[model samples]
Target: MSAPSRPADWDPRASQVLADPIAAYDHMRRTCPVAHSDYLHHSVFRHADVMGIVLDHHTYGNAASRHLSVPNGMDPPEHTAWRRMIEPYFDGARVAAFAPACREIAAALVGALPQQAPVELMSALAHPFAVQVQCAFMGWPQALHQPLLQWVQARNAATLSADPRALAAVATGFDSTIRHLLQERRDAGNAAPDDITTALLRETIHGRPLAEEEIVSILRNWTVGELGSIASSVGIIAWYLAAHPALQSRLRRKPTLLRAANDEILRIHAPLTCNRRVPTRDVTLGGRHIAAGERLTLVWAAANRDEAVFGDPDECRLDRDPALNLLYGAGIHACPGAALARLELEAVIAALLAATASIEPAGSRPTPAVYPAGGHRQVELLLRPAAGS
Candidate 1:
């Protein structure tokens, strides 16, 4: 257990933070680039500090969780091997092949939307799109979609409550679900459907088949990434476009810009809040002394918007240096599913723009999602259909 070395610098769970996290984080970055809080331990809010920590994996390790997290919770040598095995899963060919189905899912969901009426985009479009696309990609049964979504919600709630027992229960439940799927595949032998889930079953590391726990851990990480992060991203992008009619019109005019535009929009409003790291040895950061083995929180929502790195953090400039944007993260543990994520976001956004003449916000104000989640929890929008179709 790493205790706070000094008086706390901020409270992450304060009402102000819960209400508008980006604004709160912006304030923190400007006032206290590195802050200490009981909830988040030591948070690094600056881009330079965050970039340094991510790049130096040896000094700042990623084994932050007690449970197995596969590559997400691993450090090099072990992380390198797992990463090598995981990279091929998200390769260009695989992502490209999945593009059509992804787009199909997007188009179908968009078509189902009520045109020119108040629609809660999160529930109507974002959540379902994430669930359907993730299930389709993994070859999971449609029956599991609702259950999987419920599980994600439970997990997020448990995380916010910071209850160990609840967290463990949800974790066990998810592991059981994955185990059941794996068992079905095992029983079928060669008859199992050819999908990412089945392919993972045959994958080996160090010449031995991946352990059941390892596979479960990998799937769990992927599920959270898809269900939580991707879903939040869709809502954020839609809300941004709805709020900014000029940018929305520009994107609709130039469809080719959707890819970069999505990245920029997400950068301005991060869908994922923070990632964890623990220092391997004593290090001083932001003029504060952080003892070795203490917890470190990299606030991606803040770092990506650091004024030192990005002048006028809120401004979305397509011409900004891509390398400076930490949307997909950087270094060893950078999101392995980035390619797939990009494909899914672009397809869905393009589908929404093509199907809708314009997307405008409903009269009601959007509610920001609390910590452990990103983007708006409730975003009501009026999606007008195109003239012809």
Candidate 2:
């Protein structure tokens, strides 16, 4: 089959787009909802179009990567099996049980913040919170925090470089880390610490225990999903609140609104920019025809902010329908860790609010993260502790 016979719509890696993804995507959605590019082939920008593709997984397959991606890279049946095993880990009881640790981590980080001083939120709080929560959840030690953080940054760099060698090295590096942890559990046998990592070792598929490769894939997926997204989300949330003191004050006064506010803020400035897909057959989408085997990128940053659906993409409203928000995505492939993610985010924001009387932007603007990653690279904010705390 031949590729589309059209000039590229726009470059995704353009300097302007990387500088401000939301604005760039807003333009693409209006100008070319279904657009083509060298980097991201056919890009879908409308909410309706993205939802259509997401729901019809048969036509738009999830096997976009050359490497194994556990359930994420698999379709139904295969995906269904892995998902069933995975969902139990993030069930209501488990998520509820994990809340205290999450809150404790958040509170400790907040306590350590310098009182009423300009601090880089990404390094000072965001990254640490993500690392600690992930470690606590998987029952890993505190020593692994910095290594895991470094891994995430390197992985992001490899992805942006689009160099196969670089990307392969990053994947191998992560597998080594996870493999070592897995071996520790194996060495312990019956006395394996009792945590998520150990629980995964006990899981079986089709009456046989999962292979080392499968376990590595599963853990890799979880680590990537949790580490990068959570940290980016933290930075985005703090940046938003710092820029909008009125909304910050309101959320602080009404603690229950943190969940809704967090979702809204992320939707406005997505922490994860896009997810990939490939066509199983030749099909037309958003007025553009894509050939079979062609790659497609779902621009969540654009779709979530699509004006047709949200009226104003930038408007943060607590009353919007939760079903419409694609922050964790939609359909069969929706994020399994979504419940835990929400709990951690809400817990952190609530703790920060409770501890601080005000969170305002430090004089300088933040450095926005580039493609393949979302949110600010370094968000500076002045945090004032509550009186007598």
Candidate 3:
């Protein structure tokens, strides 16, 4: 792939960008909609540009990663087969069946929070909720919770470092852990507990059983989405509510709106930052020529908040069209696990609101997470208990 001759438009790792990534991305959207940088290669910031890329998968391919990524990394016929196979795992029936367990977990976590006292929401509620709910969904033991949490932290650290060796090591470790779980299910035979993990063992593609590597890859992707993105989303939602008391009270009184409200809040402040795509042929985007085979980063954080698409990106309005929200993305690779994610987010947020009379920011200012992660890293809040309960 030929590198762009134009000088770097902005440093993604600059001190200012790291300190406030959302504001930095907003600035980039206005100044350099299509930016070239050594780190991301080329980034598409505007909504229209990103939509064009995702929709034209033939021109912009999803198979940008060096490693196998199941449906997320596959293109066309191959992606079609894998995507068809995985979609049913999160179909309405399965998500509905898991709702009771999800609510139970969410309520228990909320009940445990200290009333009328300062709490670090991420550690106290967000991370643990993500880990516990994920473990419950996969039928993994509670023992894996702490280990999985640690692994997520390590993975994020390695990603930020941009060290290939560290990335490889983290990948290998996660693969090993997943392979062990698969082996245990195989050993149990019909005696194995019925769960998503076991269900994947029985899945086949093109009339053949899924390869061990494929199974591991699927689980790895699901785990990352569940643990990392879900955790970040929880923090973001809670922080937003605490900062906006009127919206918080409105949501508390009318719980049915939580679904759309959660989607809009996450749209304003994205959880997953970007997804990768590579051009199959040379293409012009945002008046910039991107060479064939060059990498493209679709900045969801910037694109969803583009002024041309959503007026006043920061405004929390529920009337806006849902199709325009890029929170879960669009086109073929649009997050297959979106249904499950929505169910999980709504359950947790509903539980939090039902249990607390009000959620207010504490003394310490919340710390925003840097690149490779979205939302606040540390959010201190005071959760006041509801009357008589």
Candidate 4:
């Protein structure tokens, strides 16, 4: 039999894994069943084990710490309570209403693009969409848009840093911006045109309205969800289609596949590679013992590629079932605004396809690079525009 594995301090594949993770995932699932995560946390790489922790609420609690992720960290009881407070604000009605606004925003951003060759889609397209949509919903000042982008980027880049100082700085900046937005929302009576900020201000939790801190936490969650995750997904979509002309054509013909495509994008290289979890008590997962307070990486990248769960995890299939991908996650913590994100991405992809017959790589575009911590790098797409368009 092979020797027992020693727990590692950090995941060595942290950076390489981000750049092109599926390769790393194959090795991890086989070798390191549960080692110290790249960030000195413990990591669980197998499919069944991740599902076990994700599905088992009692053993693996979500109430780790809000500073890490306000919504993602709150465990049961508190989690449901806080979620109940925020649920109405993110209801389908508001999400659907925002569709028109989101579509317009996508069109306007892409339309504003210069006919000039080599325009980077991330800077000009995805980044702006994420910033505008998020800040608009929060009733935040537009000037803070770029700052939010940088702050969220740092959040993704935290593990790569020698120290956590970078993450701290991003959090500080984000908290400051959130404070300003919360105060403004309060002063404005939490009212915006058919948006979340208004609902946040007006809603009551149990008996009383949510506190400014709670509002801030909600907005913080919004930024991470929109700015960091969606932006990365946008780049992934662009990179994939840019590389695969046939896939782009298929999408052009089968517009309905946009939802499936979005799921595929999220599954392939999710921005949040692994979420941290501290076990409530001793438990066995994947035949290995996991002690309490032993940090573990719920490695989504590996989970997405699990041979047991998704046969042929390496190949990207547009016709693939959307229900299978763990990109939005599962259980109570499933992203509430998933519908809105899909709408925005669909609108953007559809509009891009409608506008250009063809797109190609170009210089001056931000090269789509993935550092260990940061997600998608926006690269310039130099194009001669599709034949007639």
Please report, in order, the local distance difference test score of every candidate based on alpha carbons.
0.92, 0.90, 0.91, 0.71
Stretches of candidate 4 off by over 4 Å are 1-6, 13-19, 66-69, 146-163, 188-195, 363-374, 386-388
Task: Please write out the lDDT profile of model 1 over residues 1-389, one tens digit for every residue.
Answer: 99436778999988888888999999999999999987899999999999999999999999999888999999989999999999998999999999999999999999999987899998898998999999998999999989987887787679778799998899899889999999999999999999999999999999999999999999999987789888899999999999999999999899988989999999999999999999999999999888899999999999999988889988988888888889989999999899999999999999999998999999766888877788988899998889998
lDDT, candidate 2, 1-389, per-residue tens: 99446798899988898777788899999989999988888899999999999999999999999898898999888898989888999899999999999999999998899977889888888888999999999999999999987887787677767788998898789899999999999999999998999989999987899999999999988887898899999999998998998899899788889999999999999999999989899999977778898999998988999888999788899999999999999999999999999999998888889898999888777777878788888888999889888
Indicate the TM-score of model 2: 0.96
Models 1 onward score TM values of: 0.97, 0.96, 0.97, 0.87
Candidate 4 global CA lDDT score: 0.71
Rank candidates, lDDT, best first.
Answer: 1, 3, 2, 4
Model 1 spans with C-alpha error above 4 angstroms: 1-5, 156-164
Question: How many steric clashes between backbone atoms does each model show?
Answer: 0, 0, 0, 17
Please give the lDDT score at residue 126 for candidate 2. Answer: 89
Q: What is the lDDT of candidate 2?
A: 0.90
